[model samples]
Target: MTALPQYERLEAPAIWREGPLAQRREVIVVFGDATLMIADGRSARALTHWSLPAMVRRNPGKRPAIYAPSEEEGEEVEIDDPVMIGAIEKVHAVLEARRPHPGRLRGWLGGGAAAAALALAVFWLPGALIAQAARVAPEAKRVEIGQQVLGELTKLTGQPCASRAGTRALTALAERIAGPSAIAVLPEGLKGARLLPGKLVVIGRETVEGPDTPEVAAGEIIAASLGAAQEDPLLRLLRYEGARAAFWLLTTGDLPETALAGYGEEVLANPAPPPADEPLLAAFAAAGVSSTPYAFARDPSGESVLGLIEADPFKGQPAPRPVLEDAQWVALQGICSD
Candidate 1:
């Protein structure tokens, strides 16, 4: 077999079964270049080869490690050899790490383009620099930055409102409207809502308490999600930190503590800018939510958010589905209560 880069050749004794009812056979399992080779124990004849990427662990965290080509297929290999199991896991990790990140590639390309255009004019440099930093940033690094921002915001707003029931309700509501993301209700600071990196959505108590229906709160969450998708939160942070900080982030994937110290105050004092009408309406439509509730909530007169009110996605629908159940909505409303 050809030698694979970054992986050592390993062989171990394991029990192999062709199917659920097939009699177990002792086999010599060899980890080969991008494949697992099964050979007859006594004869040393190659039996079969399984693609390493297609291999799946059948029973995880169990005594004997069981594996299959796919979850739906019944053919399995049971290995008690720790060395072989460890090797398989390590190779899987390496492959996953090497997988392409489209966002990271885009960021690099954007940075190169911006640098090339820098001679033309210096005015466009800041926006391009911040965009490149945000684009190139890995998800893990973004999550860390988001956590730091949240911690800073907590200082001004106190810790996120939490009660077992209220948290459960909040989670359910977030999942319904915003997919799998953390929704934090702040007792103070934020006026309406803001989306941070790492899928954190922060909302003020007023957004929840002021609305008669959960749809209003849900709308705010959807709007924030849309805004974040349109404009990267990390890009905003890098811009606030300035060009020097943007360069540091691009090189080291770290932001200075002092750069973010006053960010929470700035975010709190400034109201979240409204998202574009077309995309915001599309977001509400996709989530099967009415924009009218949130529009009127933002402005009782509905004059400022006339576009949202006029183009309400679920406006004429006799009865749109509730954002949350009656009981869950009640719990969500009182999330800030002591």
Candidate 2:
């Protein structure tokens, strides 16, 4: 975010609705560290802070410009103050300029015929080309592809639950298991943790709400992330769909719907096997979580998953650190409640 020297410490009067049915209250708003700070006007005490980039105007080209933290968040702010509104608009414009243009910035997504011509010039076998494409894709393009796949999966697995507090807890848990990887918990249809391209890990509600503690759930994330390390999720999809799918995606920046038809169902039915015991244990150890709970979760009798139980890294010892706090665990279990 670019600093607006002129708008530094800009303050304005506004009315805030904390929720959809909450009564509107007089408030004082100011700019603070790329966030919009709301305060109780009577006591001048802090109420909440909204991220600048996440702010969206509910009503545009209107006298009282209504802004909310996001389209889904129900809270609202009525800002009729012209100067403050202008300041916000200016900040958004500046941030927009800095944002990358999708499909145009980098990677295999290219300009029409030019990409097609390049694709033909590469004489590598179909399998080889698909492998090459997956390996070379940039982070932005990978994320875009993963998001599109997620959209397709949603047809089978509703929208991923994202209550504010629940999402925060899930984020912390995912980061602990795998550096910066995101875990999206779906309400239904997913059988287990599915690692997607762009470091996205998808899980079913059972992982969160079924386990008494987060250790088992964290183990699921760890196993999926470990599997993804050996076989890149993007490459796995490309392999399943074959050359045509890879070629089209590289040239047009999309996965063919026909290729993805019933793909979600296929994934749900055939969950990836847990990673090799060596790596799985290493990952569990690195995360400071026990492997035994996950072992039992996989096989209650400890017959099929005896190795994970007996070879547990933290065997007979307490976890080096807790998987989650009592409050964080409670919130995560309710992630899909809303």
Taking the tens digit of each residue's C-alpha lDDT, what string does model 2 give over 1-338? 42333322556789999999999999998865578999999999999999988899988889799999998968999988664786577667555544566757544333433444343334223555577678777888778777767777889999999999999998889767754367889999776688788888888998898989898888888888888778888888787775556756776777666767766776677777778888888888888999999999988999988889999999999998888889999999999996
TM-score of each: 0.60, 0.62
Give me the runs in candidate 2 sitting further than 4 Å from their true place. Answer: 1-124, 252-259
List per-candidate RMSD values in Å.
21.4, 21.1
- Give the per-residue Cα lDDT of candidate 1 at 192: 80
What would the C-alpha RMSD of candidate 2 be, to one decimal place? 21.1
Query: For model 1, what is the alpha-carbon lDDT of residue 105?
Result: 76
- Positional deviation of 286 in candidate 1, in angstroms? 0.4
lDDT of 1 by residue, 158-270 (tens): 99998888899988888788543789999986788888888788999988887889888888888888877667788777767765466568766787556688888877776
Best by TM-score: 2
lDDT of each: 0.77, 0.78
